[model samples]
Target: MVMSLALISSCQWKKKSSKAMRRRRGGAPEIHLDLLIEILTRLPGRSLMRFKCVSKLWFSLIRSRCFSNHYLTVASPPRPPRRLYMSLVDHLECNSMAVCYNPRESALLLFTSSSSSSNNATSFDQDLTLPGMGGRNMKLLRGLILYIVCRRACIYNPTTRQSVTLPAVKSNIFAQEDYRKSVLYFFGHDPVLDQYKVVCIIVVSSKKIKRITSEHWVFVLEPGGSWKRIELDQPHIPTRLGLCINGVIYYLASTCMSDDIIVSFDVRSEEFKMIQGPPLVSAFKPIDFIEYGGKPSVFDHTRLRRKGLVELWVLEDAGEWSRKSLVLQPCQMHLVNKYTKWKVKGTTHNGEIIFAPLLLCSPYYILLYDVQKNDLRKVRIRGIPKHWFRKPDTNLFFYFEFMDDSESIMHLEI
Candidate 1:
């Protein structure tokens, strides 16, 4: 009986393996294992996920770490999966999102991990209403987003439609000191360790005592993750979301609130360092922190008379920075004159700067400036739900644009 069962199992395994391999005949009629992997790696993200059911051998190969790395490299050979999401907020705090990827509609977002869910291809533009996630402080790294809050954190991966809400972080030893106030959270990843980390900086200020204290805590994402507190001596309070590169996190911070300094934190070492900001900085002027050509760069709009020019400062090393100036052409300046409250929205990995306006009207368009060619082009985002702008001036709207190009399949592991 045991021998018969063993033979049956062996036959089943052979049958599965045979279906997975496509025997190709050449001059030598060689088995195309490398060719098979090459073809599989070039397939679309969803197509590869669906092809796993072809056989047990195929399923294992698709899910293996080796195959995952190869597929990721192929997908992002030169250009990664670039996705854009635009969020608009009105006077009454009502928010709407513009997704820029779904076919015949806006982009994709807000997925759920339902066992019976066959609706993998979801659309967020169909509905003008936004998610219940409160607060404006958020970070988008790869396809995952962390809505930073000391009280509650919403960590979500839109690619796999998986989400986990982390518990509220403990603020300080004193019960009266509310850690939620002035809470700044930065989401970063250590590519070397393949880990996602959330750095929380909570500023607990007391008016009666005339003093302020800062607390730092970190949360690393894993199967079972928890928050660990770190000792901090620096008095910097970061003002914006950090840009994580390699294993370092860089964000704009301020010690006196009059001038801003760059804060660098190593995610792997859990150490903090400060870099001095450029001179002649003002809050009224349009300044933005962007990743330019794989390094931390700043975009400053140096306004002169009715015309303005943007300066791109790229860091060559820790001590040196290269700066480039951008001025709009005659026709591009004409379009810019009509826009109000426009600012540098984002910068792509290929050094294309995006401009978005926070106007209270429709038929909105964004500007894209190429650094290499020194040319600017405007692209209008269409497919917004009709009901959002149909109300006319009854509702005021302001838009913020974000792009994610870090395409990785690790999110689907859950």
Candidate 2:
């Protein structure tokens, strides 16, 4: 009887142990989907993109509306922002004309003020081989690099590492009749309509001076269609073509011997209209025209007593122009032993006018003009060594673009 009782007790203990083992080996408790989403939403965009491969649960959590909205809201900061700085790798010149950014590191480092020169710069090192000229007339726009090589135009996205080769435009429109003159190429995009266009303006010899003849071609990338030529009723040649803003392409054209006119091309309507510019002397010619803060502006550099005097003109209204001259002190002008040539390249970003003074000098620098306060600040970057111009790294280049205010700082959802 005692032996039977012991066996029964032993069987009860065995049943309890078997129950505990089943609990440990069988299905684990399920994680609440909402809690899992909250954890994944904090990951950076680059990491989030990779996390999609983990499992279907994680992918769905990342792609959900609630998580995406929260991720974007928490990621980017509020804006009425000023300047944005982007860093290019050392190999920017050889491998590609543009440098690709790692999405995780692209968060905007905003500045409190336009003049604030804090640590607002960022760097990129990934190399991309774009199909075109190795390096000439390269401009960064809307995550795409626009470049030209041997009269062929190309638009490449460094992030995607995808390139689209534009077909050769008819040479007659840009080719010279005398075969001695050189053709000039200009390209820009219409962001509103999502269209990219290239303008080829050729200078041909007339009587004693050169004359301008231009052809405008538009490239629609939505459906990957052929180039469409736009007809201009008049024969006005453009000196420079600025990017399209608000559905209009602004061109700086010299209509007369003594004046430069601001011309606007309506991409949707395919029509041309002209805006009057400030009066100019017979010898004065327009050197550069760029869009600043959504308005057309012009820059002119000329010799005054064997010194360079740069003047900036901003369009106030349809026919009004405001002129601000940057008087480079005698000491500021460096002498070029070679051709005695000095050129000023200017562009606008984040409501400020930035100009680079290029000459054969010991110190090469860039000048920033604050349009709001009408102030000037000279910024010098200390990387290029002496004799650097002769053996230019060909690898060093600058990339500029407007930051997307909506998604500038959003965190990546995984």
- Scored by Cα lDDT, where does model 2 land? 0.47
Q: Which runs in model 1 stand beyond 4 Å of their true positions? A: 1-37, 52-66, 76-81, 88-138, 148-151, 173-180, 205-212, 282-284, 302-305, 390-406, 412-414
For model 1, what is the error of residue 83's alpha carbon versus the real structure, in angstroms, after optimal superposition? Answer: 2.6
Global lDDT of each model? Answer: 0.58, 0.47
lDDT winner:
1
User: Which parts of model 2 are misplaced by more than 4 Å?
Assistant: 1-134, 173-176, 179-192, 199-212, 255-259, 281-287, 301-311, 323-342, 360-363, 382-388, 392-414
Sliding window of 10 residues with minimal summed lDDT for model 1:
94-103
Candidate 1 displacement at residue 208 in angstroms: 15
Tens digits of lDDT, candidate 2, 1-414: 333432333233222335566588773334455545555444444455556555565556655545655664553222223233332222321222223433122211111232333332222211211212233355444434555443455555432234566666554543445422434445555545545555554444444345545555655544455666766644455555455566666767654342466777766665678777666722235366767667677766555225545666777755578887766555544432224443434454556555544432445545555656555556553333233344343443433344332222112111
Error of 2 at 291 (Å): 2.6
> Model 2 clash pairs?
45-412, 75-409, 75-410, 75-411, 76-409, 76-410, 87-122, 93-395
